[model samples]
Target: MFQKILIANRGEIALRVLRACKELGIQTVVVHSTADADAMHVRLADESVCIGPPPSRDSYLNIHQIVAACEITGADAVHPGYGFLSENAKFADILAAHNITFIGPSGDHIRVMGDKIEAKRTAKRLGIPVVPGSDGAVTEEKEARRIAAEIGYPVIIKASAGGGGRGMKVAHTETDLEIALQTARSEAGAAFGDDAVYIEKYLEKPRHIEVQVFGDGFGGGVHFGERDCSLQRRHQKVWEEANSPALNAEERSRIGGICAKAIADLGYSGAGTIEFLYENGEFYFIEMNTRLQVEHPVTEAITGIDLVHEQIRVASGGGLSVRQEDIKFNGHAIECRINAEDPRTFTPSPGTITHFHTPGGLGIRVDSGVYSGYKIPPYYDSLIGKLIVHGRNRVECMMRLRRALDEFVVDGIKTTLPLFRDLVGNADIANGDYDIHWLEKYLAKGE
Candidate 1:
């Protein structure tokens, strides 16, 4: 086990990592921007260092400042909690050069899987099914048109190096393809510094399902299970549930084997997620997330596994202590991403939280960073907290989540709680009969 580690991100995830360190008897140092100087994670950590200004580029995303903080704090490792530099391969390489363990996969694994095009090819070669489309990146409009004809109409163009719904365009016909291709290429170049874009068959209503896997660089890996992230807005997940009611035992085993083999082929280590798009009873590999996901708590709730501790143990040169056969998932767990935004307009509402109250009881977990009097910052993501609930089954889980969301209150700033409450109690979500476009249709009734 590491003697000490530095948390390189902020908000609830930073506090999440801090609690993990505490349980492992590891000392923790938290790095924060000036805006989060007095945040809860900073107060809970053994030591706190101000990295830079409020802007993420100079603070949370600044690799050098974070490494320097680790040096000053005498920490032996660094844990990036899900965002900013967590998936950056160069950051991992720098940590390696400094002899500091990056509590995730190796630099090579990240670099290989970080690029969407490369990951697709890798999955294809490993016999994992991928959505049929372009052979590789299309450098010109002519080539893109040719590929679109071969793959049929209604395809999606995406940045070879993109995530978070950026650098993506859907083309319903040949005319739309020309404009979408040019615009997508330009946007991809500006955002990722890579003009590379690839085409894939666009499923109109695919369910987002991902498997959580853990590996020890030593040829041993196991999947905790899958999370149904079908409840989304604009390609970003809002609510996630474990042991997807949509997947049967046979499907679960099939997907689990596929994920384990894909990463195991790359000699992957540490914690990661293999994301897939499921539609019409068929599954296709979409991409792989190289860091811990925001919805990981749902998996933990069902499996009773401490993923952070697994990462720490794996980093200390240990293999998976438990085998795949020993793992068992019980009950259904759901997580709602509570964001600082208006439910009606979906616009950010950053301000001081005047009155704050959260629910507490059986099977309710609240992972939050803000409290009474804390001001929400506008420069970063609008996420304020994560509300998780567990129950004996899907119906009970839905009921518990609805009850929990009703009790969650943030007085000053508007939150997405109302939207989540409406979602959880809806007949579709309650019965698990929703697709990716479900939320959009529910909102479209208003528009």
Candidate 2:
């Protein structure tokens, strides 16, 4: 049993996990950099420790510092919330060596799935359809060009170890393949310290679909349904919804079953999201996030499950509390990631939140890590809050979301509130008739 858990990351997600721990009667120790001293998670945690300076590498990503924090704080477990070292297998191993539970899956599962090329191969072996791409990392321009030709012109060069849309570039012609590969490799090396690059057929106008699957590490898995994350910008999701409008019940069951079976077969445990790109009625595997997603609130909204609580309990060897048959899908839900930025230009806006008032009422949830007087440091992600709403149907959910967004107010710093205010009024968004490219095109046209 975990006595005290040390949260190894900052931002809203740290607050998110802390809330779950509080409900479970578990103590928490929040580790933060100097810049996040005023973060909500730090304030609410049972104990707080400053690991290092403001930079992520010096603090959040520093394994030794994190372990030291846990050791000194008497935390029995470490919850690496979403980003930073959440999927880092080495970090998991480090925690294991320290005899501190890592509140996620096994280190091996993380290592295997964190490698994109190897993960794709694993997916294919398990009968999960992967995007047509290089069988492995392409090291030569000739090989990349040949793969591009075989895949028929439009191809994407991706860093095998990359994420967050970095280390990815598209080439529509053979002449552009070499540059795309080189740029991807360079960026990959700089970002992930691994220059391994791969080629994949560029899918145009596909919906970003993901299934939330939880495993018991004992040959059983359950799915909490799917989320449509098609509305994205530069690979980061902007808006998310549960029980995708593009998918009917039959389609949902088919894909959901495939994902559940795959996780069970792998003996995977804890919360994970299997992402895919859907086009023309077919789902192609993209990647799997071994930890809870930033958009997990939507899934929780529909499933009525506290995923963070589940993750902590599973790590503490409590096993699954609910089975697949016991799972029930509730009404629709949507989440809008409200960021501290210019609504139109997307420039970061960091400063004091002069005034703050979260929307309230039935069917609305806002996960925020900042308060009115809190000074949002410029050294981190701009996401200040997650505005989620649940309803009997998608229509009601959207209506509630719009009303909540209207009622929401954060003064002093610019926010993407205006962007979302306009987004909720778009017809395509209302009808769920947009693709991955739709948002960019819509933004480009200044809609």
Candidate 3:
């Protein structure tokens, strides 16, 4: 086991890693920006260091400062809790050069899978189904047009190196394709510095589903299960549920096995997620998240597995102690990302939290970095907390989620609580009949 792990991030995820280290009897050293001196993780860590100022580039994303912090703290391993530099291959390699474990996948895997085009090719070669489109990057407009024609109309142009819905443009016809292709290339260039784009068949209402997998570099691991993350806004997941209501036992086993095998075959270690787009009972590989996901709580709720603990173990040159067959995913678990944003306009709300109250009951978990009097810094994401609930089934989960949400109180600032409150009572969401596009359309309709 690692003697200590340095957490190079902030907010709830940093706190999440800190708690995991505590249970494992591993000391935690948290590096934070000046804006996060009052962060819960910083307060709870065994040792703390101020990396830089409020801006991410000077702080959480600064490599030299983070490595220097690790050296100063004498931390043997690093646990990058999503976002920031979690998927940066160069960061992993730098840690390796310093003889410090990254607590994630190999640098090679991170580099290859970080690129969407490379990831899709890897998935397809591994026998996973991918959306029909260009075989590789479509550098020319004529090439993109040809590929679109072959795949049929209504194709999506995506950045070869992109996530979070940036550098993506959907075109319904040939005329639209020309304009979308040019604009998408420009956006991709400006955002990723690699104007490389690929064409893919766009399913109008595909459900975003992802499978959580943990692995040892020794080609051993287990697939915890799948998460239904279709409830999203602007490609950011808001509500996520485990043991998707859309899949049966057979379907779950099939997808889970495929994801696990792929992870193991790639010699990947630690925790990661294989994301997919599902439509018409078919699953298309979208991309893979090389680090822990925001919705990981839902999976932990159902499986009772401490994923961060697994990452620490696997990264410490240990294999998975739990077998795949031993994982018993019980009940349905749901997580709502409580962000500090306007409920109506979805604008960021960064201000002092006058009062903070969390609801507690059976199967309710609240992971938050903020408390009363914590002023939310606007230099980063607006996610303030996560509210998770588990129940015997989806219906019961819904009920528990509603009750939990009702009880959740964050005063003196706006939040997306109202959106969730209304969503719980909606017939479509209640019945689990929503697709990826459902929530956006529903919200736009002012329902």
Candidate 4:
């Protein structure tokens, strides 16, 4: 086991990793920007280092400074808690070259799965189902039009290296294809420095289902079930639930087994998520996240697994602790991503938190790195916390979630708590009858 681990991110995730390390009796070193001098993670860490200023490029994303911090602290491993450098293949390679461990998959695996185009190809090769569309990048107008016609109208153009809904456009007919291609290409180039784009058949309404898998870098792997992240706004998931209300026990087992076998065959290590678009009882591969997801708590809540501890163990050459049959899904779990934003206007709300109160009770958990009197820095993501609830079933879970949202409070700044309160009371959300586009349509109707 590593004696010390350096966390290379901030906010709630940083604090999440710190607690995991402490539980395993490992010392922790947290790196923070000047803007996070008073952050909760820094305060609770065994040691803290100020890397740079507020800007992410100068601080969190600065590879050299992070490496220096590791060297100075004598940290042997780095647990990049999502975002920033978590999926950077180059960063993982650099750490390996310096004799430091990266508590995730190898750089090679990250490189293959990071690119959407290559990930699709790999998924298909691994016997996983995929959407029917272009074979590869559609470089020319003629090719884009051809693929759209072959796949039928209503195709989505996506950046080969895009995420978070950027560099994506949908064309309902042939007339819209040209402009959609141009816009997607331009956005892709600007956002990812890569003009490459691909075409895929767009489903009118599909639930976002993702299977969580873990590997031991050997030939062993297991899956922790699926999360229904269908609720979204501008492609960002607002709410997530485990054991997707859409799938039955048979469907869950089938998809989970496929993902587990794929990870085992590929010799992947640590935590990874295989995301898919599900509609009409069919699942189509979308992309793979090479690191822990922002919505991991819901999965943990259902499976009772300490994913961070497993990551540390597997990275230290210990094989998987649990077998496939040893894993059992227990209950329904939901997670609400509480962001510092206007619930109605959807604008960023960054200011001091004057009064803070979190809900408490059985089956309710709040993971946050903020407190009263703490200032929310605008330079980073506006997400201040995640409220996860677990119950014996979906109905009980929703009831618990509603009660918890009502008790959650934050003052001196706007938050999306009201939005969740309204959503919980809606008929569609109550019945678990929602898709990826449901949230956007709900907001458009001002319901």
Best by lDDT: 4
Can you list the residue pairs that collide in candidate 4?
Answer: none
Q: Pull out the clashing pairs in model 3.
A: none
TM-score of 3: 0.99
Every model's TM-score: 0.98, 0.98, 0.99, 0.99
Model 1, span 49-134: residue lDDT tens: 99999999999999999999999999999999898999999999999999999999998889878889998998898778899898
* Local distance difference test, each candidate: 0.90, 0.92, 0.91, 0.95
The model with the greater lDDT, 2 or 4, is: 4
Q: What TM-score does candidate 2 get on C-alpha atoms?
A: 0.98
Report the poorest 10 consecutive residues by lDDT, candidate 2: 215-224
lDDT of the structure predicted as candidate 2: 0.92
- Clashing pairs for model 1 are none
TM-score winner between 1 and 4, please give it. 4
Report the error of model 1 at residue 329, Å.
1.0
Candidate 4 matches the true fold with a TM-score of 0.99
Candidate 1: residue 232 lDDT (0-100): 84
| Worst ten in a row by lDDT for model 3 | 213-222
